[model samples]
Target: MFRNIKTYREGALIEDEQIKSYVESFESELLRGISTLSALSIIQRHPDEGIYGYQLLKELEQETGRTLIIEEGTLYPILRKLERDELVVSERKDSGGRPRKYYKLTTKGTELYQHMVGFFSKLLEAITPLMDIEIKLPEKKFIYCPNCTNKIPQEAEVRFCNICGLNIEGLSK
Candidate 1:
């Protein structure tokens, strides 16, 4: 007495089990492209002490309020990519019991994270009007450089903008 939910895949109508696999594949593709930020932010959270994969995943879930649950298949690849990019470094350590590979942001990663977080915040604020949402970023705490407009925190001792090399020392004062 129930009707199947039909979805068009490529050209043909797909339903039931086929639709599930088709949709899942499509979902994974979409996720794979833009999921690094969450993982990066998690690793970025811990500076001196690095985080293991499982702990990072759990923190990611908590940070996003349990909305995003990333699988190990996706997380590991992203970590490897970040390591290859020199954005993060991993070390195997035996903290208390079993040895675990912990990941932490490199100096470059820290700078990149600042810029990315700033950009993301600005992007959210910029798109809020279109999305019919409101976001109030702390303007006083950040330095939106006049030259590049790359967002950065005022607390950081930055003389020139990391992205555009704009002189911001005077502006920081």
Candidate 2:
């Protein structure tokens, strides 16, 4: 495809293979899936509840129905980065025996989260009508267990995922 384009430009004759490889790499970076939004969503739903690190992992896993791809190596560094940005703050909690660090979003973080939600909602609204599709809200449903992946039928402020054992805001499915 790029072979003909190379000759069309008089001065610069870029090779087809070289151009193809460069374009592919650049596109991959642009399409890489990142979930900073998921983190924001978690904070927004539970503004007052301080979230534990392990709980975040479980929540993400259950919500997406995919492995978070965040292993022992990368989790702490990302947490530190978020904390450094002041979007989230960490504190220690000693409940029964051991101490656990819980993360809570600051006021600025809350506002940012709400803004992101609205922006994405508006974007979806614009795209859907153009595609000739009708968007309908789903009825309320039970929260699925993050570990067991079982659905819990009752409505609660926060529901625990059985599959991964993470607490999540109960939203209408």
Candidate 3:
């Protein structure tokens, strides 16, 4: 027989079922955006020799210190979507006795990855000032627009953001 669920007014302890549901909801919401970007990055890394679904999943886990936990069943649909979007392409190859589908980024995908890198870099930079801990990017000789985070070469003398049209002359001073 199943136990009857009790309310707080009844002074019953919170059930394991309730806690599990809450955790699952929270994790799913948090990973919604991140999972797609992570998958794309994994595919991007194996450009010369494309990687299959299982291998891609393993590499993602290893690269993220096991923090980006994506389910095996969930990865394929994402791959299919990427292929449909023309961001990646896949080919089936005979490996030993089984046909494995390998995925690699297209030219468009590479461009997208670069754009995403800039976006995330700028996003983090904008928020780091408010955080208690300081986060720094690896030493690079590039400058980013404070308004739009558009990266410019250290040697460029541009006074405005090409993307957002924000005047950046003040930052140089």
Best by TM-score: 1
User: What lDDT tens digits, residue by residue, belong to model 2 across residues 29-128?
Assistant: 4323245556656645556768777777778667766433345445667677778988788899985597888888887666455444444444555579
Give the winner by lDDT. 1
Residue-level lDDT tens digits of model 3 in 1-173: 01122244433444466874776678787776678788988998888889899998899888987778787798899889989999899999887799999999999777666556667777776688788657676325556666656655556687876667788674643
Tell me the whole-model lDDT of each prediction, alpha carbons only: 0.78, 0.58, 0.75
Pairs that clash in candidate 3:
none
Residue 14 lDDT in candidate 2: 42
- State the TM-score for model 1: 0.77
* Model 2 segments more than 4 A misplaced: 1-34, 67-72, 124-173
Cα deviation of 75 in candidate 3 (Å)? 0.5
Estimate the TM-score of every prediction.
0.77, 0.50, 0.70
- In candidate 3, where is summed lDDT lowest over 10 consecutive residues? 1-10
What is the per-residue lDDT of model 1 for residues 12-58, given as tens digits with 9 covering 90 to 100?
A: 54545687687777876766644777788888789889999989988
